[model samples]
Target: MPGLGVCLALAASAAAPPVFVPVERFTLAWTHSIEKVRWEEDYAVVASPTAGQPPVLQARTARVRGSGAGMEPPDDAVLRNGWYEYTPRMGSPQGLRLTRSPYTADYAWCVDGQCVPLGQWLPSDGGVTLLTPCARPPAPER
Candidate 1:
């Protein structure tokens, strides 16, 4: 990594270096362009089971406000506080790749109740922005 941060990184393109972040967990929030329903998926930085392997991103939970065709929450989702919340059964992925555009609502990385657009980290230019868990090295001793 080119920065002094941990857990996750977002790269503007395949040729670009990833922007390391000090986040252990964050929620990816967005609204469907067609249905206009809000969806949020919670994720965490998970360490690799094998030694010396880099960490990965894991889906922890999910929630959606309102439902429509193709936007229904899982069967186990519970309606709580106007949002259907549930634990996503999708297995852990190595990283998340998000494509951004002016035609659709931007994705937000929410942490501590603050949600910032992914564009803040990298401007969209019709390319994919990759978010992946990064292995932060131990701080060097002075």
Candidate 2:
């Protein structure tokens, strides 16, 4: 019975709540404008102000797992410059500025009125680049 108690303790500690801490901030510049960015934990958002268009806002959410300090381009990424790179894992919210949430070890794009359940990280499951995010299908205004 004492051995069983030890196993339970170990499992409980292994599943500690995710530790969320802001790791870094980078600006995303584009032809039309730039975006101010900051992300951690379950959310990543990019905001851009256009000349005549409503400011673009892309918000993404995921179930956080673990935290890390930084990110490196995936094996198949194309290096554009010191701060810019391209990876096949790009998602709908493509942007020039890219980041993998340090607070999210595993993730999924949260979409649909009923959010998708957590799933494995897809190679094409990253956040927006330094550009536009996935636009919604037009729906009739109520």
Candidate 3:
């Protein structure tokens, strides 16, 4: 019985958590007007504290518009948001797809509804590019 107990402890240590921590949150801090719009597929980079753990890739869907929608806009409104979690096995090759045009610079990356930096913007292709100046590690919370 003692030997079995030891094995169980070892096995449990190797398991990953069912949910990951939400490091940071942000809202639209700034906005930029683009001359042209393009629809591209991108990935959101997330961090995990566990060592030897791979970065998480979340799917993101975004849309931009020249003007804001009036009261009770259409279901396919000009603006939309989606959140995703990271998987260790998938790595960064797979990310969310953005199916909108007129990409506006006004949209900002955020966590928990707060504005964050460009570095937080993890590319779906496994590239770490800092899109903003206020890049910081995500807090240890949901």
Name the top TM-score candidate: 1
| Cα TM-score per model | 0.83, 0.21, 0.27
Better of 1 and 3 by TM-score: 1
What are the RMSDs of all candidates, in order? 3.6, 19.4, 15.2
Model 3 misplacement above 4 A: 1-33, 36-53, 66-107, 117-142
lDDT tens readout by residue for model 3, 88-132: 233333322222123434234455545543323432222212221
Model 3, residue 48: C-alpha shift (Å): 10
Best by lDDT: 1
lDDT of 1 by residue, 30-98 (tens): 998889889999988766777767876789999999999977999999999999999998768867778
Which one wins by TM-score: 1 or 2? 1
What is the clash tally of candidate 3?
A: 21
Compute the lDDT of residue 55 as modeled in candidate 2.
Answer: 25
Q: Flag the better candidate by lDDT, 1 or 3.
A: 1
Model 2 Cα lDDT, one tens digit per residue, 1-142: 0000000011123343222212112122211112212222222332234443322323322211222244433444443322333423333243333343334442223322333223322222344212222222234599
Quote the RMSD, in angstroms, for model 2: 19.4
| Best of the two (2, 3) by lDDT | 3
How far residue 113's Cα lies from its native spot in candidate 3, in Å, is 1.4
